[model samples]
Target: MHMTAQDSRGSRASTIFIVDDDSGTQQLLADTLSYKGYATRCLSSGRLALTAAAEDPPDLILLDVMMPDMDGFEVCRLLKMDQATRFIPVVMVTSFNEKAMRLKGIAAGADDFISKPIDATEILLRTRNLLLVKQYNDFLKEHAGILEQQVRLRTEELEKVIAELRTTHQQLVQQEKMATIGQLTAGIAHEINNPIGFIASNVTSLGKYCERFLTFIKAQQTTLAACLPDPDQAERLQAMGNQLKLERIIDDVPNIIRETMEGVDRLKSIVMDLKCFSRVNDAEQSIADINQCLESTLNIAGNELKYKTIVKREYGELPPFSCHPQQLNQVFMNLLVNAAHAIDTKGEITVRSWSSNGWIHVSISDTGCGISEQHLSRIFEPFFTTKEPGRGTGLGLSISNEIVRNHGGRIEVESLVGQGSTFTVSIPMKSQGHG
Candidate 1:
């Protein structure tokens, strides 16, 4: 068997290995290689060389063409076949100078060839070149592994970002639908109120006529009672009283008028709320109570959430901040309605406001199905929606975001899927003064 190559102190060196059947030739090559700062090993036969390489392969191998038991061709073939030893470069060393024999060694997987009576310098040069090639190969393998790992990490990060964008898009779509509904509320209220107003007025007039007619009949009854001592008129008076039915008319007229009035009042309040929530005026900046705006918006949306959800308000003390009241009203309205709709069955929407650090913060939270982590980053993007087609237009939050930004404020959101979502809006309480 080929002995393991060692340095002067018996530690393995960065290598040059030699294999030959002739002991003298193997020793010569090993000594020459060792003198040139290369670690060297020598083996007596092809079988022994193959065995040694399988145990502890060198960086480069020099195999003799002619050997006992197995030829150099066979040894080279075996080395190339084994994955552990395949990378070691093999240079066939031979005494025969035939072209065919050299070609045979090459075909058997020898990386290079050196004809013997080998020159010391030639052996060293060939070994040095082969070692450089091996070093370069190792570097490439390591670099490839690192590149693959980086690509995998980057891909994961990108996937997470994409998921967040999708979610944000969905939220913005819902907000847009709410905003559109807010804009149309005023017209809708006006259309319903006109008919309600006249109907209530007519009911009031009819009630008064009924009361007068009943009073006239009661006066006739008092006259009949005064003349009751005369039995002749008693039967005629009773027949007249029963035909008029004055008591029944008096009892039923008031209830009809009251019910009509109540319906009209309810319709009128809805119209007032619609006007407050619509923000139809075009003003750049105005001072207004944000809490009042929230209340109006909730009132306008009452019909929307009446059967679907409940709204809870936790309004804190807020200093009046300079803002476009109309635009801000739109923002609050969109957020409130969106929160209500997020619930699939029954849910609660919470609106809270507070002031701190020279800013006013409004938080709208929902107890419905919440947003997922992947979609949180994209909630304000234009045309994003989680709602079905015809139910959403996806531009509400995007527009709200733009309006808030114009007023020097920012909107942020936090959500957990299957739990709930919260949106926080922060706006500067006072505009920056010009120098």
Candidate 2:
């Protein structure tokens, strides 16, 4: 029975190896597979076929089950055991159609079977279908590998983006610190200038007083040298002393020195307070009195509030708590500044502190333009601001919130429009402090 199978694409894109003891069967498979656009190689024995397959694997194998010397079943097992040739499809050709023979062939790794009176159509169909399945499997594996590579690349890119974002956030925090320092520098410069200016003026006055005293001493020496003093000499000496105001100079020098010393002390206190507030690098926590810190911050920020707000303190008794003193000072400064800004004109800002239930609560209340409920919820969000542009950076409350939370604490607020707002900062007696 001579039949020609259709070559689907009319190209030898697939190779089929035929192993048979029968020359007729080998020639038939060759012609049939070649006509179906499959390239074919023929071997008379299973040994030749096994050797050829190991040297160069084929896409499919058609083996006669009852071959001499080495049977097709043995050949199939050998091919299946080899890693390189195992994926190739194998079809068994045998006259025996018994169920036992079929099971035996299947166990030997045969993909399909054809009878002795082989139907050309059956052979072509089985081979074509198996080739299609193998092709599809290969394609899927290739696609999966590409997908895995792409996933790896995307993960790396995401990690890089996260790193950049973290760096930018840190930079913003540092910029805010510098901006706060800038504001403090302006106020402190003015504050320090006041006492220094007056002290310089007092030094000038003291210099004039010293010169006048020297003149009085020289006149007194001249009068002493002439023991038989004339009335006119005595009168001249009294006049000179009166003109010099010697008695008044002697009395005022001590008072002037005292006042100058007081001014110097004031300058020192201001400097010390500023140093405490700006201990940015001293991130270590220590036992500190929040009340004392609040008072010092109040004094440091006094220049900003003095003109527009009257700050009143209602301090309550409190024990020292563990905290980063410098950071808390910054929070106090920010709160006071915000309170002052809320007031358009003169107003009262009262700061109160107390210790209760293993925590310390510090409250800053202002009688000014209060925050609306709509904006209050977003107040702690970074870069959120209600103040006019250029007047605020909107980082104060956000930073304060982070600091408080880090210190094992929290902040609360109460407000009424056009009435006032109160910000209460609460901290545990002992913090999980950071360095």
Candidate 1 colliding pairs, count = 8
Instruction: Write down the TM-score of every candidate.
Output: 0.47, 0.39
lDDT: which candidate is best? 2
Which regions of candidate 2 deviate over 4 angstroms?
1-12, 21-24, 44-56, 66-71, 74-86, 145-159, 177-435
lDDT against the true structure, each candidate: 0.78, 0.81
Q: Write down the lDDT that model 2 would get.
A: 0.81
Local accuracy of candidate 2 as per-residue lDDT tens digits, 1-435:
121222223343677899998999888888887887778889989899999999988878999999888998999999999988888889999999899988988999998899878788999889878777666655676789999999999999999999999999986976586558646754775677677777767766775776687678776667675674577877786688789996687667767766776766666554544443333334777889888999999999989899988888999999987788878988888899999999999999999999898999999999999999999987876567887865665768866776786688889999999999999999888666444
Clashing pairs in 1: 163-374, 164-374, 167-375, 168-378, 168-379, 169-384, 173-394, 176-396
Residue pairs with colliding backbones in model 2 are 7-36
Lowest-sum lDDT 10-residue window in model 1: 1-10
